[model samples]
Target: MKENEVNAKIKAAQINNALGFFILSFGIIILFAMIFTETFIEHMTDMVAGLLLMTIGGGMMWKAKINIHKLKLNKTNDNK
Candidate 1:
């Protein structure tokens, strides 16, 4: 891959990984707070919200992986 594309791919991967971890961590925080707060209704709502956040994060990671794969394929084709 070109230098710029390579850098872009790496940055995208890092951002995606960071976002995913953040989502997962936020989910954990929600659960922890629920345990301490004793607000059962709010607790379940937080859990569902957390799940949605993590799902979005997972999608970001998947997109990054695909972009990286495409970049690699393009590089290989360029070499040929």
Candidate 2:
């Protein structure tokens, strides 16, 4: 891959990782709040929403991690 292409991929991976972290953090916060706060139990919808957020965030983070790993592998192969 060209230098510019490699740089672009690196940047993309960084962005994805950052976004994944942000989302995962929020999801964790929501999950914790749901578990600890009594108000969430009163509103079952909120609990469900929190669960959904957690699931989606986890999935996104996993996907981003996989993408980063793939990029690193490709970069190493290119170097070899």
Candidate 3:
């Protein structure tokens, strides 16, 4: 109900989304790799897209984790 709780929930949601995207992106690359073995360029593109998605998702997940940790600490302090 309070600010920290709300923020923690939001950050948790964001983390879930980032992770989901990251996993899905890899799944796409893997599927394409099998389907495009004859095309080197297509494989490269798939790898690049997968890497980009992973980088972006990782950053977002890191930010969410920091926020979640801060919220947890605040909650702990409030309880004490």
Highest-TM-score candidate: 2
In the predicted model 2, the residue pairs found to clash are: none
Error of 3 at 72 (Å): 0.5
**CA lDDT scores, all candidates in order:** 0.74, 0.73, 0.68
How well is each residue in 1-80 modelled by candidate 3, as lDDT tens digits?
58766776876767676785676567566656656566888777677776666676666667776766766787678778
| TM-score per candidate | 0.68, 0.71, 0.58
Choose 1 or 2, whichever is better by TM-score. Answer: 2
- Residue pairs in collision within model 3: none
Residue 54's C-alpha lDDT in candidate 3?
66
- State the TM-score for model 2: 0.71
The TM-score between candidate 3 and the true structure equals 0.58
lDDT of 1 by residue, 1-80 (tens): 48687768778777877787777677667756665656778878877877777677777767777876877777677878
Q: Can you give the lDDT of residue 62 in candidate 3? A: 70
Q: How far in Å is the alpha carbon of 35 misplaced in model 1?
A: 3.3
Weakest lDDT window of 10 consecutive positions for candidate 1 = 29-38
How would you encode candidate 2's per-residue C-alpha lDDT over 27-63 as one tens digit per residue?
6677666656667455576567767777777777787
Candidates 1 and 2 compared by lDDT, better number: 1
* Model 2 Cα shift for residue 69 (angstroms): 1.2
Q: Is candidate 1 or candidate 3 better by lDDT?
A: 1
Residue 55 error for model 2, in Å?
1.6
